[model samples]
Target: MEQILANGVYLGSQYAMIALGLTLIFALMNVLNFAHGQMYVIGGFVTYTFYGQWGVPFVLALFMSCVTLAILGALIERFLFAPVIKGSSREESTMLLAAGIAFFLDAVILLVFGEKQRGVPKIVDGVFNYDFRLIMPYDRILICVLAILSIVAFIGLMQYTKTGRALRALAQDRTAAQLMGVNVDRYSMIGFALGAMLAGLVGGLLVTITGVNLGMGGPTSIKAFMMVMIGGAGVISGAIWGGIILGFMEAIGLALLYQYGDITYLLIFVSLMIFLAIRPQGLMGKPWG
Candidate 1:
């Protein structure tokens, strides 16, 4: 039971991070980023290169990847995504463009990294064991702590600061925000950057547990999409909730279904479908105005 709970919480944090990125991007741009997972993949690779290969401190490697991914995200927004948003019907175009970007990045990673999976050595190797039953590792503990801090910081940014106000305003109403001189374009870029940073951070963290490979992005992206939908579209809090639920479900599935890992996702899909059939806007989503 303790083991199950620990795995659930650890996985929940990763899912929340991924879901948060997707929600942030969707809230601002009114489009889903098909390539967002690629950023996560690249982030893990960057950390592997630094911490695993160059012998940089693990925390330092994470920081380096965070900064690099932020810059890369901004560049992607400016060059790849921004151009498509100007079209008469940008919702579809932006999504398609992002899909194109994801495919291209996947190919590039495959060519560069090859088919081999890469591992990130433990930053610290020790387990917290109590009563010979409860056990937790330091790295997973760190993942959860960082996840909490990131969520808190994200909420603070959205609620308290000036730039955060601008982002909130843009999300609530782009045309009205523009009329109020909020600069939707700039805020959208910032949102994308922040979202990408979150995804990259998760990627780096997950490499410690799941290792790094070209295919990691696809399943993660799908799970994130499920989280965003199940939690509630355009609702950050919903993503967090959805992530936790999904994580717990997966953990339980592992305990009960054991050998049927795929059943977990199938169950999630069925649950989501049933929920949507009853409430199309999602768990916390307000009907589109």
Candidate 2:
């Protein structure tokens, strides 16, 4: 039971970290980026190529992956999102463009990497024993620590920095923020890039625990979307609350059914229904205007 609880916390932290990027983008852009998952997959592939294939140091590879994705996110904001928003029908065009990007990236990945699973070499190996009875991988502990640090850094930035104030202003009202000389366009690009970087970081971390493949992003993206929705669309705290809840729910459900056979999908569906019906605004969601 202790092992199961520990494992659940570990997995939940990863889920929360990944979901944070998605929530940030949603809050700022009000667009559901279906392609966020592809960015994650691409980040893993970058790490695999640089570190796994080219013998680059793991830390450097991780940095490179994050930087590359951040640039890609900026490009996407400029070319893909900006145009759609400037068009006659912003909402429809934005969704379609994002969906198109998702499909295109998925195809590109399938062509380049093929359909095989590949794991990123572990950053740290060996296990730590607690009370000389239970053993857990150091890697999992590292993931939890990273997750906590990331969350703290994010919250600090939002609370203390000028850029954070701009982000909040934009999130609340873009036109007003622009009127205040916040440079909404530039800030949007930066926000998008930051979002991508976060996703990539989560990707690198994931590679250490689970193997990566071309098809891995789709499901994870869907899960992140579900987490965002359950947390609330425009609330940062909602994302954290929703992600932790979903992660623990998933972990507990899996453990419970490990002996009873496969019921993962069913459990997920039930949880979703219960959350939606009981707390449609989510645990930390702000009241809608």
Clash counts per candidate, in order, are 0, 0
- Tens digit of per-residue lDDT, candidate 1, span 1-289: 8888887988787788889988988888887888878889998998998989999998888887788778888888877777778754646788788888899989988998787899988866898888867788887888788887888898999899998899889888999999999977788889889889888888877778778999987777888888888788888998998898889988878877868656876886788899889987778888872
Question: How far off is residue 39 in model 2, in Å?
Answer: 0.8
lDDT of 2 at 28: 87
Q: Candidate 1 has which clashing residue pairs, if any?
A: none
* Maximum-TM-score candidate: 1
Assess the local accuracy of residue 20 in candidate 1 as a C-alpha lDDT between 0 and 100.
93
TM-score of each: 0.94, 0.94
lDDT of 2 at 280: 78
Model 1 root mean square deviation, Cα atoms: 1.7
Candidate RMSDs in order: 1.7, 1.8
Which lDDT tens digits does candidate 2 get at residues 82-160? Answer: 7778774657777888889889989988998788998877778999998855568898788788877888898899889
Off by over 4 Å in 1: 259-262
